[model samples]
Target: MVARQFIVRHDDDDHHIEHDTDDGFEVLQSQIFSLTLVPPDQQKILANVNDAAINADSDLAAVSDRLVLVSVQDQREISISDEELARLLQAEEEAVYLQQFQASGNRREFENRVRTYVPQVFLYEDPMRQEAARKTVPVDEIEEKSLIFLAKETSGHQTMKKAMPSYWSYSLGSKNLSGGTSGMGMGVPLPSEIQYGGSRVELYWCNKCSKETRFPRYNDPIKLLETRRGRCGEWANCFTLYCRTFGYSSRLILDFTDHVWTECYSHLLGRWMHLDPCEGEYDKPLLYEKGWNKKLNYVIAISKEGVYDVTKRYTRNWHKVIRRRNITTEADISAVLSDITSECRRSFSREITSTLKIRDERETEELETNVHIPVGDSLSLPGRQSGSKEWRMARAELGSSDQNNSEQRHKDEYVDSHVTRIHAAFSHLTSRISKEGVKAIKKLLEDLRASPFRERTAVLESQGIPHLGDLLEAISLKGSVRPDGRVSVGLAGDPVLTSLALPVALDVVEKIINKGGNSD
Candidate 1:
């Protein structure tokens, strides 16, 4: 009838606590019993200030500002492993999300909805089945009885695990040469076939009359199961579903730089393991960046439980990735992802939510720490494991097998891209600017070219031209194009900018400082 509270600590657990009021003091004892396993009769609910038994809410209030309960049954605390608690919390959260999901959706549309939510990233692979089976099946079945046969079939054996990487890499299925392909649609696609992205287009070479058409990238796992084919997108999509179907808590990892993979909780290893089904690679996070020389800007992981930004997990050189990360502000990205994750757990208990928060922070610490690890040359770093040689070469996704050739070029690409941006936007100044200014600018370019990529990168980030109007801000030279197709630049009062210098150059520089406009 009356609301009350207590800060209860039992078994020396730092984080876990119990405090609630129900029917009476007896009910509170039952609550403590549930957590500490000390019978209500043996437990002593006492106030910290005076060790007095808290018989009633008034007695608890008399002891201190807040009530305190402690089990005096045994001299020692109860045994509760962190692992056991985490697994319990995770399962509880899953049930909440699943419950909310079931209350609102049609089973037939579940797979399609996942694709619509995250067109390119969602993993919704379901095997081919009859209409009755498809309509009747649910995720609950997979969650409950997934391992009854799947593990025994493909992944359970240690030898099969080793053979799997090579099989999926080379034998699973060949890459679809026509990327922008939609397979063999004799006529235009129906409304139901229209995908979220423009990826379902009829290719130029795909003659509908001939029926020899581009195969559209399939999202259905059952179809992928039969075909056993596709790019990394298909591989990860299908593989993640395999993991989920096998009862492993899995995530579909999407690299914005055109790659996808899987991460599943490895109870044997006590952590999540990276998996590239297309490459037949396992536990090699750096295989893409270090092995294939990928310039990753973003990597995100999505699962039924939550969404996570996992970019640092794949990248060794965080600075380079940061420079390329212009898609959105980092804060906005975090806020949006956190909002989505929070929405999924809106109905979850506060204790479960707290555990998730701790897990999120711990995962972040792990991923960020990984960002600093020195890039290593692993023997497992083979070039472009999945797709054909031609496709791999076309994508330039070679691994360490070709690292010797690409190592230097990789550095040059970084330096050149920045230097080229400088040239494209500011090179015109050489002709219109004063001779002294032109000489100084050319000197910097020469120095930048000769210096190491790291040095050049530092110089770019420090003061290089990010745009047409902001060239060499640290050096006091600025330029902007005029609205009427004219170039204007500013050279700080230097010897070349005297009465003796070209009047045209001075006029151009003055106009740039005065009226900033678009480039020609």
Candidate 2:
């Protein structure tokens, strides 16, 4: 048999007319049937439908003597079944549509399309369960799944929302009282009260109320709120969930020494800021080593994005941290990071992957160059750079203000403790200006006189007393102080308590009458 070629053009392009080649014609026919070429004109190509008649054609017979019949579409040079042709056309249309979308400037639109290819990551509260799931997934799939997990909006609620301004102000102002729940009332407090509350009152409440459980629980924020508290690990876990619920990108940072906190990504600042719910502190990475005097080893931050060894942020000196770090080699860390990042990026399109890779490189550069280091000069510290006199004075003022707050906090605690002690001793005393009340008032007066002007103010404010006038009014003209601290207008004609308490009452009254004017 001799090879034959056929010239074919279904569109404007010139056709390569192969005059005498069997293989070329077969390939060309196959291309047409595969939808590479527009289907040939039906009137010209299908002269005869019967196999014998098609085999009789000189051009068709040269390629294949069998000359099996094939279906052709009218719109294109396609010799395939109708269903297959329709699918190929739809696929082509979709490809073009995606190309157009990707070329457009809308990053969100492109991201939406890219997400279809990524597998959904269902992260659990349990780390062991999460590790099991992680093992089941390919390394390349981790990043995309992580991104989805980070931004997962379940039931239209964001897990990582930015916190309110009041919260920030309160967090920044309040002192880090690591333990004790004294002075923090159970009732919901005003925003200003939290700022001026003098301690981590919420953490106090959590510690006091939450039942101690032997089994570990990485409770969500809602559950923690309901239960009122947990261990340090649970506190950090819940706090992280709270940040995420508010639409903030937060990571759960775990220290080998059994401490956990959160690192939130600040979009405005374009970096992670350390936040500790237990301490009521933010952006204080060095607090662990410098303030708490902790000896840390591995500090890992695990987020949906990936797992990162963030020990460098807390440790100022690399040599010291390296010695302490339990990880055998830096190469292992790098390998783990690479595997996680690759898994996260697995489902991303080339463009998105490239963009993220570049961004990651920039972040790595920033992390390496900007890790906090100790400064010899106090004034040379980051954010407190030596500058104009005005700047120096402002820094000094801030330092002074913090010191003053601390001092006032201690004084307020003293008064509160004394008052609480009195309450404890005279548990059945109903009236604030009774014999027992009078004695308590006398003790408070003696303490208040020794206290600086600020402590007096703090006691008044903290105790819900409006002014010194009210206190003075209660001392002189009262039968007894009311539950609300108001003085009764009339004098007490009857003595309810035994004579033993009468002297304490009279003594308290005499001291208040003489010292009320000098109290300020």
Q: How many residue pairs collide in each prediction? A: 12, 25
| Model 1, residue 172: C-alpha shift (Å) | 12
Best by lDDT: 1
User: What C-alpha lDDT, on a 0 to 100 scale, does residue 124 get in candidate 1?
Assistant: 46
Q: Per the 3 Å backbone cut-off, how many clashing residue pairs does candidate 1 have?
A: 12
Q: List all candidate RMSDs to the true structure.
A: 25.9, 30.6
What does candidate 1's lDDT look like per residue over 193-286, in tens digits?
4442224533333223332433345666555555554567767776666566556777888777877788886543324668777766677788
- Candidate 2, residues 69-93, lDDT tens digits: the string is 3434233322346775456446545
Model 2 global lDDT (CA atoms, 0 to 1): 0.43
TM-score, structure 1 vs. true:
0.45
Using TM-score as the measure, the top candidate is: 1
C-alpha displacement of 342 in model 1, angstroms? 1.2
Residue 463 error, candidate 2, Å: 29
